[model samples]
Target: MKKLAAGNWKMNGLAAHLSEAEALAGAHAQPGCEVLICPPATLIARMAQTLGDAPIALGGQDCHSADSGAHTGDVSAVMLKDAGASYVILGHSERRTDHKETDAAVRVKTEAAWRSNLTAIVCIGETLAEREDGKTLDVVGTQMKGALPDGCTAENVVVAYEPVWAIGTGKVPTMEQIAEVHDFMRTELTARFGDAAAGIRLLYGGSVKPDNADEIFAVSNVDGALVGGASLKADDFGGIIGALERA
Candidate 1:
């Protein structure tokens, strides 16, 4: 399976920042991994244009459930697809905590992604206290079960495990810990969805940097990564991609 190295720029980036996208595209992307950048909505189309014929692909941070509605200030999956996004991230911990997005809401959005022919990167994670209490697997399992929509296939769906405590905190779990979580997730997914689940790519997120990407990607069941801070720079993101290729 090809590894996916997705950059979640979140709410950052402006018109001028599109140059970074150009830089990334101009650079050599790792041969064995897929590179994707999810910039702010305003820059998706432009970045998509800039990345034309390049190995890099464009993604969206989020998308509305409805194809078209009166929801003010909301962008739909169709709109994101029209803007040239091949993927849409959903149920990120930040969105769940900061925006109060529920599991059912994420399901709706996942369906929207399917309707628009966009791959959905569904995120699940646990907080520091939950991890301390040894409830990491339970929390992640519950979120995954609730957030994933029915009829999802490996081709159209991806799962990302992002420890809420580690994100943006320069913290990361040990290789054993990450392997344990990802292995458990693989079992849970296989039980729920059969062989199709076995093929679904599982990505690790939270504080993933170039220095540690190789070790993290080497862990069992960790097929790729969902990067945050390190993704802001072309060199850093490209370095991480290179690490995955070596892994």
Candidate 2:
């Protein structure tokens, strides 16, 4: 399976930040692995325009479970697709913590993404408490099983493991820790999805910076990275993409 380097801009970025997107497109016009950027909902269309004909793909931070409804302040999967987004992130930790989203909700949203012909980048991970209590595997496993729908394929779904405590904390897990979770996720997916799981891309997210990207990418089952703060800049994100290409 081809690797993927996804950048989640989160709630940041403004009209002026489009210049960063443009520079990123200019710098890596042709990348070895698939490159994606999920900026705020407001910038999707403009970023798409800025990256015209570039190899980069645009995605949305999140989407509503329904195609259309009375969910005010919510962007539906269809809306994201219309906004020039080919991918939509679902069940990010921030969504789970901030909006109290459940795995069941993420599953439906993922289905909604597929209904709109958009790929769903599903996020799952354990909290600091869970990890400290030796429940990391169980937490992540349950979340993974619940968030992914029945028809998930390599073509439509990408899973990202972002430990809640590690995100933006600058405290990364040991390489062994990352490998264990990734390998476990692989085994879980293989058992549940059969052969299709092998082709599914598994990304590591949580304080993923350019300087540490190489060693992280070298870990087993780490197809690529779902970068956070480092993704806000073209230079920083480009370093990560370069590392994945070399991996």
Which candidate leads in lDDT? 2
- Candidate 2: segments with Cα more than 4 A from true spot: none
- Runs with alpha carbons beyond 4 Å of true place in candidate 1: none
lDDT of 1 by residue, 20-107 (tens): 7777777864357888899989999998887778888788988999999899999999999999999999999999999999988999
Q: What TM-score does candidate 1 reach?
A: 0.98
Clashing pairs in 2: none
Estimate candidate 1's alpha-carbon lDDT, on a 0 to 1 scale.
0.91
Q: How far in Å is the alpha carbon of 209 misplaced in model 2?
A: 0.6
| TM-scores, one per candidate | 0.98, 0.99
C-alpha positional error of residue 121 in candidate 1 after TM-score superposition, expressed in Å: 0.2
| Model 1: ten consecutive residues of lowest lDDT | 23-32
